[model samples]
Target: MSTTKGHADRDVTEDLLDGVAGWGPVLCHLGIFELVPVTFDLGIPLVARWMNDPAVAAYWDLAGPEIRTTRHIRVQLHGDGRSVPCLGVLNGTPMSYWEIYRADLDQLARYYPALPQDTGIHLLIGAPEDRGRGVGGILLRAVTELVLDKRPACRQVVGEPDVRNASSRRVFRKAGFDFVAEVDLLSKRAALMIRDRLTLYPYEIPRFDGYS
Candidate 1:
């Protein structure tokens, strides 16, 4: 795996994600959100359970067992620094899972007009309470901002949610991702969502009355 000097002078590998482990927390409307890099021993069970949720499994399809989810995460954890899996913590609680990757270097590049430094995001709101209440869109926008801010080379953030998953597609749209096209992937047809850095500010998260 590739390594880079990051926060606190640590040798954080996964440079293809531009030192994501060092990006730290971002304060959003909902709460303080952070994308902590995933560790197998601490992450597997929680992630596996989330994968088994019917709503998540419908699109993610990694519903069977812990080993199934383990293998999925293992590939990224052990591969070249093109992807990084993380636990999305909100206000000190790990409530979601995310995979931040280099879309230009992924198999996804074969399907789209991939540009250098095009970041990709794969997310699942793990808890039942966090779903269907605009949390997805809120975090999508927050994470997109993090990518654009932390990875200066990334001009756009992209996602390929299964086309049949309307709720997922809707959240992407609500978060400022433009529906670029429908691409057929090995597993399912996907809606290509792109959030261009050039036009992101208009849809940026708004400040609430009491929040700093």
Candidate 2:
């Protein structure tokens, strides 16, 4: 929690991210670009836009007014100390929103066999314009590698997007994820998607200059 003065100092979150010395310089480049934390200031507006759009809002189950959605995003920024709230940035621009959480501590744990090192992900691209250009598959691959690399103990990464979202399921498949099963979650049928660490790295991913 660092001090940021309005939008003028919005980039201040960059400094707070840098100060985590234990993370080392490797974190400065997450596979390709930066996987920076979504700070208080940056999280509010960008998240509001993504969650309120008619095309996307249904995926997140955030309905009613804009203020309700904003509060939901704020609570995540404030109280979600268990997971990493991430911004997938290419060069310096934020391209997507991502969260990497411990499966044992996640709601999905009850539905599936929980493992000590399993990680769960929730993701959505922030811009509606970038929905179906095959950009999502690329972003999914990058974010998956970043999460696996960040957690050395993690052996598998999992996601459950609504089964009704056909395009999202395609992106997961393109990114090398396998469909496990469909489970009822949040009152919607979600397709369980899994990508093993080996699947993300083994012979699947090409060598990136900054990637370990």
Candidate 3:
């Protein structure tokens, strides 16, 4: 059976995000970017639109016709409870799509030696305006820091960008991940990249008053 079971603890992550304080109080970020969990109450339509955008679909390799509908997104969110659907918001506007998950609970873990603490990322900038402007690198760095900081047990952050996606590889390198050879996965050759926890932050979980 799968180690990952059940659905998202919508109450825990969603309800705990921001209660009586409202949207303003719940707004947290790493520098300029805000990462929010994609909840059923508020994130469904938003993510659906982003996924259907031509530019976003092309960059994310989903350039087909209406492939990522709301239903598809919902099913993806239920993946073993380890996958988290998130949006990268800047100045209250969503700019990117991010899927943060545990590698040990993922099929990708079979491609390499995955530790229980290995967290993986699937990222894509949603807008054409956001791409080619170094936003991917900056966001990736902040995201890596955010993930490593938020999950104390995560010893490393990993990514497997298709080898043909040179831009993504460069962004990963800029965000402190070292290239670890090409691996065949899902019938595509991917470049394995990793960044150990010790390299980014010396402390395991640093105190962040506003953000974690």
**lDDT (Cα atoms) of all candidates against the true structure:** 0.84, 0.65, 0.67
* Residue 48, candidate 2: C-alpha displacement in angstroms: 0.5
Candidate 2 lDDT over residue span 60-92, tens digit each: 766566677566555544542445567766656
User: How many clashes show up per model?
Assistant: 0, 0, 0
Candidate 1 C-alpha lDDT tens digits along 1-212: 11122342223344567788878787798988889988777788999999999999998889997999898887777666677889999888999999998888777888878889999999999999888999999999899988988888899899999999999999999889999899888788899999999976855443323335
Between candidates 2 and 3, which one is better according to lDDT? 3
Candidate 3, residue 180: Cα displacement in angstroms equals 0.5
| Higher-ranked by TM-score: 2 or 3 | 3
Instruction: State the number of backbone clashes in model 2.
Output: 0
lDDT of 3 by residue, 174-208 (tens): 88999887887764678989999889956433333
For model 3, what is the alpha-carbon lDDT of residue 109?
A: 81
lDDT of 3 at 9: 59
> After aligning candidate 1 to the native by TM-score, how far in Å is the CA of 212 from where it should be?
13
1 against 3, candidate with superior TM-score? 1
Model 1 CA deviation exceeding 4 Å by range: 1-12, 202-212
TM for every model, in the order presented, reads: 0.89, 0.76, 0.77
Q: Which stretches of candidate 2 lie over 4 Å from their true place?
A: 1-32, 63-66, 203-212
Higher-lDDT candidate among 1 and 2?
A: 1
As for TM-score, the candidate ahead, 1 or 2, is: 1
Q: What value does the lDDT take at residue 178 in candidate 3?
A: 92
